[model samples]
Target: MLNNKRRFSLMTTNSHSSSQKVGTINGTKVNEMHAVEAPLSGAADEAFVTSLRGRFVEGRFVYRQIFAIRSYEIGPDKTATMETLMNFLQETALNHVTSSGIGGDGFGATREMSLRKLIWVVTRIQVQVQRYSRWGDEIEIDTWVDAAGKNGMRRDWIIRDHYTKEIITRATSTWVIMNRETRRLSKIPGEVKKELVPFYLNRIAVASEEKDCEKLDKLTDDETSERIRSGLAPRWNDMDANQHVNNVKYIGWILETVPIEVLEDFNMTSMTLEFRRECRQSNLLESITIPTTRVIGESNNSINRKPHLQYTHMLRLQDDRIDVVRARTEWHFKQKLQ
Candidate 1:
């Protein structure tokens, strides 16, 4: 096993080597570049390669990376979809763990966690989007972790435009350990805590917003103006390395019941998801949405005003009606983006 100091040194050495290759475009420095073209012969080489993708900052307590928006990641509006942004956040978090030398064979799991057959599971997440990135845009994302209450870990991210340094999105999430074999929640092992405690930072990515202050109300079938979409199942490709449907897939399903008009005319400015249970490939699911406030009509004057459309969403198993996830979303007119 590599000691913390040695691992950190390896990262810095690789980062300095990569920086020497950076070039300028039209007098502006181009910082984004591919990792070194070399064979991964051992763990040390693998760590060096991973450092090229992302690196630790702020005294090695925070991770920062830059990603360029691709064509496939954009929607009809020409801006990167919410799912793409979420994926970026997830990727950076995992890379942070790997670079820290605490990661094990399991995804983002510490060595002690892998020995105990434990994996991390996110319970809740909140994302606020002030702006969306367009195709060919380079966005920088920074992520850091801190303690959540006693047993839980809190991770937060800030996404910004690489050139202007303007904030685009902010997100925060809570995660806990679960036994991979038993599929039950587990407490943090002492050894795992010791490995992670030194890297924790007291930071807030999304401030001025309520943190679990108000509970999202459950939507029922009897509710008026409720929309339901049934007969949803996960594809084989939807499964992550953990042999279960990826959490990002749940966000797509939750929006299936939303009105097309809402999706087209408005941009989702904020979303909060509470994952209650896991979904598998064989399970059928149903999506339900209830409008919490009336959808605003489009008008010439609406462009200048900020009006929010709110909805509550639920995803449950088709047969047992067991809630898989519950969420609340807030949207504003697309004209606001302009």
Candidate 2:
């Protein structure tokens, strides 16, 4: 087994060195997850329609709808930031639900799951914006999963534009269930799980990247075997078009690993994460993940992790091959972590 943390030779060449372990404990195939295919819906079918759904079991069901917007201007749109667009697209995706806000429980309460002591958490979310969405457009979102888990379940979603009937975006997600009091992952009952087994697990979400050497050099020595434990749950407001956790939801997991005080010390200026995977609907991701952390100093705010960006985050799927999604996030420092 390779060490989780590694040291590299600061050679005379133009590349930086990095050390990584070959695999993970639970057989999580990180690189094997990413990319999704829509039956190719056009940009004209997305709209706020809640009339499409099938009640699998007594309490289990599907949620579907569409957003009526078009092209979200990337870079500088005079009215949006990629971050703002990311957050907007996600929220827009989530507006379809008959439930307030988004995610499983909020949607669950509306469906009367009545697991009163349980709550839902979004572990990880990956998004691929082949093209951005625009205003004055209508989008459709489809969500469903055949079953439930003790601590989590899987959920799938798709976003289609109405006027053109083109698929704007698609994604899958993993989530876990938690005890309200203990806040620990629990196993779903057999009866409950068996009820939704019809919804087969999708392949997986995988991402590709050729991160520069600078990213490797940014990791701190102690960041070798970093594992993110828990984070704030996905709130009603955290939902997007398909009524599932949004891509920007991944950032929550990124900073959720850092203490509040530490997060406050830096302003996220630049965040570059490509989605190699998609998450399903009603899936409360557990986030039992460990990634490498890298940090660098910048003179001024140039990207999203603008001015004083202090910290950088690099997360990977502990695998023999390279990980699927290698996120490199930059945060500027307002103050050092105390």
Best by TM-score: 1
lDDT of 2 by residue, 217-267 (tens): 333336544544432356666665335456566665655555565454544
Q: What C-alpha lDDT does candidate 2 achieve relative to the native structure? A: 0.41
Q: At residue 255, what lDDT does model 2 achieve? A: 56
Off by over 4 Å in 2: 1-62, 70-75, 78-113, 146-152, 194-218, 221-338
- The CA lDDT of each predicted structure is 0.82, 0.41
TM-score of each: 0.81, 0.41
**For residues 1-338, could you state the per-residue lDDT of candidate 1 as single tens digits?**
22311323212223656423324435675455322333335777666445438888899999988888999999999999989998999999998998899899998898899999999999999988887899988888999999998899999999989779988888999999999999999999889999989999999987744443468767665872468989998999999988788988988998899899989998888788999988889999999998777556653432223346888899999998888999988788786554
